[model samples]
Target chain A: MIEIPYNVKPRQETGLYNAKLGIWLFLASEVMLFGGLFSAYVLLRVGSPVWPPGGEAQLNIPLATINTFNLILSSWTIVKSWIALKENDFKGFKTYMGITLLCSLIFLVIKYFEYSAKLHHGIFPSTDNFYGIYFTLTGLHGLHVIGGLIVNFYLWGPGKKMWKSEPERFTNRVEVSGLYWHFVDLVWIFLFPTLYLL
Target chain B: MSSQNLEHHKSIYLKVLLALFVLTVLTVAVSFFDFGSITLAILIGLTIAFIKGFLVAGNFMHLLDEVKPIYWLLALTVVFFFVLFFMPMLWEMNLVTVE
Candidate 1:
């Protein structure tokens, strides 16, 4: 049997499993990636004589707000799913994970309408600097949401088999996936205010 | 993995969820008010955002329970992130005037 190191126990020196450490490092890089774009946003807004440039190009605040709550609810559900797994409540885990996935799809669907609305109005990314950055930032974030949804879907579906065989490892896997899901939620937490409110 | 830890997380998760919801509403409410200065409005919005972000990261992501090396890594990332932000300031200063 090939041992998967630190799946259940922490390494003595760092007191973390391999997957936890790796996820944090990955999140740190994700921070830099979003950080760079955010810095660009700030600079562009500051340099522009008229920030947002056009009233017509303003984002749909109400829709974005709804999506914000959607992501937040998903965040809560993902954590709850992990908690269910920790308690060995497979049914509860599946229920919460299903809700989390539902929220993800709802968010993307709302985003789809929002984007289509912009396109219908002929608001392309090349419309202006504001739209340019708006599309770029939110587009990248939407991609992350899709990625997280795929992971959660797999775990909730096919990956449930791990529960019967290696429950502890299964729990760790959910925790790791939860970490990523929360990161995606956190990104939207910032992105919401930046693009919609401000 | 203990019962105590699980219970603790459950309580914290509920509290954090409530806080996040409250903060989201607060951000939206504040946006309606004219702070008299765009900069001031932006500042308040960003401050609220950072608070919400911290709550999610520290609680939901379990950053509060993470190890030292991870903190060190994040600290380093923060340093570089700020450096990247400030690099533009140097350009605006006209340190090297280019025709």
Candidate 2:
């Protein structure tokens, strides 16, 4: 069996563990991916005579506000989960990670409602330029949330077994996973205002 | 990474969580009042978003205490991100209007 280098220790050359550097590098790319679309949104909105087609008259604000809180809470819970692991409290780790998972689920369920309402109202991505970008930006974000949830869920469940064999490595995994969740939350922080308000 | 520091980290994390909650509410409330021009309103809204972004990145993501290479890499990322954001303004002269 081959053991992975820098799984638990910092690399001397870069001063970061393999997964840590890998995730941040990945996140930098993710930032640009979203940044490009956000640029498109700004260009479209700017050229249009009426941004948001009359200053936020459309779109569901209240539901979006709720989603904002949901993501924020999840961000906190994920950090708490990492902290719990750091403190060697398995039960606390499970509890916090579970809450983080639940919050993400709630966010998606509310998003499903918001999307269903729009479709019911005949507001498809093809409906107009505003709806087009709206669906594009948000749909891509929703997929990120789903992706983070998968990695987080894996860490929260079957991945916990590694705690006994290699506790520090497991905690480091949680930390890296927490960072990804926070990035997703950070995206929504900007997305909420850009889409639902202003 | 030290057991002795967990308590300190916990305190800071709780403070950050409260700050984030308050900022989220402020972002929602600010949208209700007209800040005069659309440009001004957007500036205010985006400013608040940026502040919230900083709090999450610094505290929740632990970027404040990240290693040197990671910081430089992120700094580079920020530069490119702004470049991407501003590139669209050049295209602003040509708007895509859908009827």
Candidate 3:
């Protein structure tokens, strides 16, 4: 059997483990993905005569504000969970991880209500350019949140077994996942202002 | 990482979390008032959002302590991102007039 290095420390030359390097590469590409959409947003808004065309299509800012805080709180809790794992406190890790998962659900529930309200009023992606961009951007972000939730759910559930077999690797896994979660939250940090506020 | 270093980072994370929450409130509060121009409002809102992002990425994501290659990767991404963002401005200049 060929031995695969799952928990290799930082290399002497690049100073990064394999997974760390891999995640960074993945995030770099993710940056370009969101960056392209943001560029399109700028172009579309700039080309339009009236920003957010159609005066009746208003976003629910208060609900979005609550969702923003929910994501931010989740980001904090995810990190706290990672720290708990680092400190060898499995119970604390589970508690924080559970809170993080709850926040994700709260955010998605609020988003569902917001989407339904807009759709109930006959507002949708095809309604206008603003709605088009609004639905595209927020919907994509919501998908990312869902992705994070799935990974987090696994880590909080069956994935806990890895901690016993390879403790350091488990901690590293938590750290990497936490990094991705923070990135998702960071995207929303910008998205909220771009869509809801401005 | 040593326990001491972890403890220090833990404190920093807490501080960053507090800063992010405060910035969120500030962004919402500032949005309530008219800033005279939509462009100005955007500038202010994006500025706050940028600061919040910096705190989260730097502290929470541990980008501040990341290795050199990661920084290089992000720097390259930023360059391309800015190019993509500014491409529209170039089109608006009408440098190549369409007959």
Model 2 Cα lDDT, one tens digit per residue, B27-99: 9899998877988989999999999999999878877766789899999999999988986685454453347
Q: On TM-score, who's better, 2 or 3?
A: 3
Best by lDDT: 1
Q: Which residue pairs overlap in candidate 2's backbone?
A: none
TM-score for each candidate, following the candidate numbering: 0.95, 0.94, 0.95
Residues B12-80, model 3: lDDT tens digits: 887888888899999999999898998999999999999999998988888877778989999998998
- Chain A structural similarity (TM-score) per candidate? 0.97, 0.96, 0.97
DockQ of predictions, in order shown? 0.77, 0.76, 0.81
Model 1 chain B lowest lDDT segment of ten: B89-98
Docking class of 1: medium
Task: Judge the docking of candidate 3 as incorrect, acceptable, medium or high.
Answer: high
Q: Give the TM-score of candidate 2.
A: 0.94
> Which segments of candidate 1 are over 4 A away from where they belong?
B95-99
Better of 2 and 3 by lDDT: 3
